[model samples]
Target: MNHPLTDVTRTLGGIAYGGDYNPEQWPREVWREDVRLMREAGVNLVTVGVFSWSRIQPRPGTYDWSLLDEVLDLLHAHGIAVDLATATAAPPPWFTRQHPDARPVTASGTRLAHGSRQVFCPSSPAYAEAADALVTALAARYGDHPALVVWHVHNEWGNHNALCYCDTSADAFRSWLRERYKNLDALNDVWGTDFWSQRYGDWEEIDPPRDTTAFRNPGQELDYHRFCSDALLTRHRAETTILRRIAPRVPITTNVMGTLEKKVDGYAFAAECDLVSVDHYLPAADPDGHIDLALNADLARGMARGRPWLLMEHSTSAVNWQPVNVAKQPGEMRRNSLAHLARGADGLMFFQWRQSRVGAEKWHSAMLPHAGTEGRVWKEAKALGAELAALREVTGSRVHGDVAMLFDWHTWWALELQARPSDQTRYLDAVRDWYEALWTLNITCDLVPPDADLTGYRAVVAPSLYLLSDHDADNLSRYVDQGGHLAVGCFSGVVDEYDRVHLGGNPGALREVLGLVADEYLPLRTQDHALLEDGTRVRQWVERVETRGCTPVLRFADTTDGGPAHGGPAVTRHSFGRGTAWYTATRLPVTALREVLRTLCAQAGAHPVVDAPPGLEAVRRTGEEHAYLFLINHTLDTAHVSVTGVGVAGAEITDGRVVVPPGDVVVVREDLTIAPA
Candidate 1:
C-alpha cells in the first residue's frame, strides 16, 4: 500500500521557514506589519488559526471567517503560504458549559476546567462531534485556497489530555478490550489475573489501572496504555478522514512532541500523518543540550521512515514553563537550527512568530521578541531564514545511519512500573547513554521500533527494553542469525507483551539466540559501584549471569566482600550463525560504553562520517546527486577539518582543509559524479 507523500517543496518551492502566526491575538492594524516583517525575514510558510476555535465559532453553531479570510488573503498577497489549522485543539468555554462531560477527568476523578488547552475527554461523544464539525467547515471553505499548502490538524495530540478515566472512557476501554481479547477467558489468561485471586468472570470487573492502594496489575496497566494511545489516535483519524474526503490534495500533519512525549506511541501516531513533524525544545540548564537535539532529530527521521521531517516548534531563546527558563546565548540558536537541518529536518520553525504580551506564555521566546525588531532574536531569525532558503537542495535528502537503536513505547511504560528491581533504572537515561556514546564518536544513529527492518543497519542496540513480544523477539533473532550484529542491554526481554514473566529464565525468548542465561538480579544501591576486570566501572544494576554457549569478554573483578557476583561474567560475546550477539549484565559508564561501542561498530563495519574533533558535531545527509556533510563547531576555539567538497558561499574552505570558526555551522556538498581514474 502506498501512503500519500508530504512534499512541502511542491508548494513552498524551498525549505519551509516560518512560525505559528496568530493574527487574532493582535489588533487588525498590526496584521499588515506582521506580513511586512515576515517578507523581510524570508518566511515562506506560517501555521494559521491553530487555537482560534473560540474566535472562529463564537457561539455554539455560529462561525465568523472574516478574520481568517482577511488573514489568509494578506499572507497570500505577501507571497507567504499557510499551513491552515483545524482549530480543534482547544474547545471554547461555551462548548465546555454545554457539554461538561467533555472535560477530561483525572485519574483521581476530578474533572478539569477549561482555562488551559487540550481540556477535552478523548472518548467523549460531544467533544468528537464538535471537533469533527469544525474540521469539516475549515476543510470545505479553504480546501482549494491558493495560500494553503498543508492542513494542520489538532495541535499536539496527547500532550495534555492523553488519558481520561471517566465512565465514558471506562465503557470505551471495555469495548476496545472486547475487540482485542474477544472473551473474558482470553483476557484473563493474557493479564495473568489468576494471581492473587484477581481473575475476572466478566468484562464489568475490568477497569483502567486507576488509583489503587497497592501496585496495580502490570498486565492491566500495560493494556490500558495501549488503549489510551489508540483512543487519541482514533480522534486524529477522524479529523484526517474529514480532511482527506474534502481536501485530499493538501497533505495533513499534526506537530508531535519528540522524546518528551510519553503518553502516546509516537511511531503509531506518525503512521497516520502525511508528513511527520515534531516540536522540540532544549533543556534550559543542560550545557550539552545540542546532543539531545540531535537525538530527537534522528528519532523524528526514524518516525518518517528515513524521510525528511519538519521541525515544527522550537524556542528562539528561553521558554516560560521551566522553573528557570535560561535563554540561548548568541549564535546558539543558529547552531541549534543547522544541527537539526543536518540531521534531516527539511523545514525549520518556532513556537510562535510574534511574542505575546498578555498570556501564560508571555515570557516565551519568539522570532519577534517583546523588544520587537531591535532584539537579537529577530536578527538571528532573519539570517537563519536566508540560510535555509539557500540550502533548498537538501529538502528531500535523507539521513543514513549504519546503527539502529530499538525504542519501544510499551517497553518504556512497563519498565517504569512500581515494584521493579530498581527505581534507579530509568529508560530514558539508559537509552541516552548509548546514543550519547554514538554522538560523541560522530557515528549517526536512528532510533527505530523493535519490529523495524534490521537488514539495512550494520549494528542494532537494544537498551533496557524490559518488555518484549514474541514476534519482535523472533525478528531480532532472525536478524542476528542472518549475519547481523546485535547488542542487548540489561533488563531486556524479561517479560511478554502482557508484562508477564517469561517463566523459564531471565530474558526469556532471547536466551537461546543470545547464548546466555541470567539467574538473579542484583540492583545496586545509589552509591554502590562494581569494578570490571578491565578496570571499567559499572553502576545502577547488574545480574548473576551463567553463559550457555558464549564467551565472557569482561568479568567482574575479584573482591573480598564475598558477593555472589564476585567474578561473574559482566559482558559476553556469542557467535550466532555467521554473526555476533553481545550482552551486558551490568551498566557500563558512558565513557567505557563508548569504547565498547567503538569496538562493536568496528567489528560490525560501521564507521563515522568523519573524524571530528571533540565538541564538534558531524553528520551527513545523502541524496541521489549529492551528499551534504554538516560540521557544527560547538566548541569555543576555532578548528580545522579535512574533507573534499564544495562549501556553501562564505564558508572558509580551501583545498582539502576547511576552517570552522567557534560556534558556527558549515555544510559541504559532495558531488556524486565520479571523475575517470
Candidate 2:
C-alpha cells in the first residue's frame, strides 16, 4: 500500500534535513539571513506556525496572515519547502478569557492556568469551534501556495492536560459510557461497583475518576483514559476534515511523543493521520539510552505499518527541561540521526531552526545555535546534511524484522494503576529489558499491538501484559498453535479488559498453551533476591507455578520461608502443536536474560543480520532493486564487525569487515540477485 506522502519528488526530494523554523519570532530583516543559512546547511524543509496561534488570530474571528505569507514566500524563493502548521496547539488568551470553561480542570477541581500550551478542555464546544475556525482560515489562505507540501495539525495532543474532570468532561464521559454500555446496569456490572456501594443509579451519577481518599475503580480509570484519547482524536478529526476539503492533495499529520509521553494511544492516533510523525528526545546522562531510542523508533515505524515516517522533533544538544542539561558529546548527533534512518524514518528534523533568546526553552538546542556557524553543533549539522544528500538512494525502502514485541497502551495503563502485586513491576522497564537483550544479539524487532497480524514474525515476546481482552488472548493461542514461538513474562494475562481478575488461575487465559497454572504470587521487598537454578538471582516478584505438561527450564533454588516454592519451576517451556511456549516466573537479571534470549532466538530459527559485539547495532532496509546494511556503534570504543549475506556479484560493499569508530555509522549496499532453479 502506498502512503499519501510516498511521492518522493513532491515530498522532501531526498531526506528532509531541516527542522522547526519560527521566522515570526524575529524581525523581517533576520528572515533573509535565516533562509541564506538554511541553504548552507542543506535544509530542504521547515515546520512553521506551530505555536503562533496568539499572533495569527489575536482576537475573535480575526486573522493576520501577512507574516506567514512572507515566511512561506521567502522559503520557496530559497528552494525550501514548508510543512505548514494550523497553529491551534494553544488557544489565545482572549478566547480562554471569553470562554473560561475552555480551561481544563484537574482531577482535584483546580482549573489549569492559561499561560501554558494545550490548556483548553478537549470537550468544550466553544474551543472546538474556535480551533476549527483557525484551521479553516489557515487552510483556505495557504492551500494553493507553491511551497506548501504537508499540513501539520495541532501540536502534541494530551501533552499537558490529558484528563480533565470539569463538568463538560463529566457530561462527555457519561455520554461515552452510554454509547459503550447502553444502560447503567451493564456499566455497574462491568465496573464491578458492588464492593464499595459505588453502583450507579443513573448515567448522571457517573463521574470522571477524581481525587479520592482511597483507590478508585480500576475499570473506571481505564475507561476515563480511553475517553480522553478519543476526545483529543475527535478534535483532530474535525481539523483534518477542514484541511482535506481545502487542501485535498497535501498529507495531514500531527507530531506524536512516542514512549516519552504515555497519555495518548499512538496506534489509534496514527490511524487518523495521513502519515505518522514522532518526536524523540534521548536522555543526556544515560549512556544506554540509545537502546530506548531505538525502541521508540521501532514503535513509531510499527504505528506506520512499516511505512516510512518522519522524525518530527529532537534536540540538537541539551534541552532545558532536565535537571542537569548536558550537551551532546562529539559524534553523538550524527550517530543518533542515522539510527532513526536505519530504523524507518524517511526524514530527519530537529525541534527548532534557530535558538530562542527568550522563552521557557531558551536553552534548548537548535540547528543554528546562538553562537552561529562557528560552534560544533552547526558543523555536525552541516556534515550530516551532506551525508544524507549522498545517500538519497535509500529513500522509499522498508525494514523487515524477524521478531515482534507486544506494546499495548491499555496494558501499560492497567498494570501501573494504584494497586498491584508489586510496586517494582514497571511495564516499560520489563519490555525494555527484553528488548535490550535482543539488541545485544544484533537482532531487529518490531513493536506490535496485541491484535496485529502475527504471521510475519517467527517469535513474539509479551512482557507485563496485565490487561488482556478475549480477542487478544485467543489470538495468541492461535499463533502458538500454528507453529510460532511465544515468550511471556510474569504478571501477564491476569485480568480481562474490565480489570477483573481471571479467577481460574494466574495467567488465566494462557494457562492451557503455557502448560502452567500459577496458584499465588510471591513479591519480593526491596533489597531482596532469590536464586535461580543457573545461580543467577531474580528479584522484584516471583510466582508459584504448577506445571501441567511443560518442561522446567529453570527452578527456584532459594525461597523466603524454605517452603514449597523453593523447588518449584521458575521458568517453563511447553510444546503446543508444532511450536513452543516459554514463560518466565520472575524478572531475570540482565546478563541471564541475554543468555536466555540468545537461546530462544536460536530455537525459533531467528538470526540477526550480523553477529556483532555489544553497543553495536545492525539493521537492514531493502528495496526491490537493492538492500542496505546500517551498522552503528554507540560506545566510546571502536567496533570491528564482519558482514555476511552479501555475496551477490556487483554488490557495492563499503567494507566487508567494517571498522566503525566511537559514535559513528557505516552503510553498505548490495544489489539484489536473481536465483535460478
Each prediction's RMSD over C-alphas, in Å, is 1.5, 2.2
Tens digit of per-residue lDDT, candidate 1, span 260-372: 89889999888999988899999877888899999999999899999888888999999999889999999999999999999988889898999998889889999999999
Using Cα atoms with residue i matched to residue i, what is each candidate's TM-score against the true structure? 0.98, 0.97
Writing each residue's lDDT as its tens digit, candidate 2 over 398-438 gives 88888998999989888988888786899888988998888
Model 2 residue 482 lDDT?
95
In model 2, the Cα lDDT at residue 197 comes to: 93
Model 2 lDDT-worst window of ten: 644-653
Total clashes for model 1: 0
Q: What C-alpha lDDT does candidate 2 achieve relative to the native structure? A: 0.87
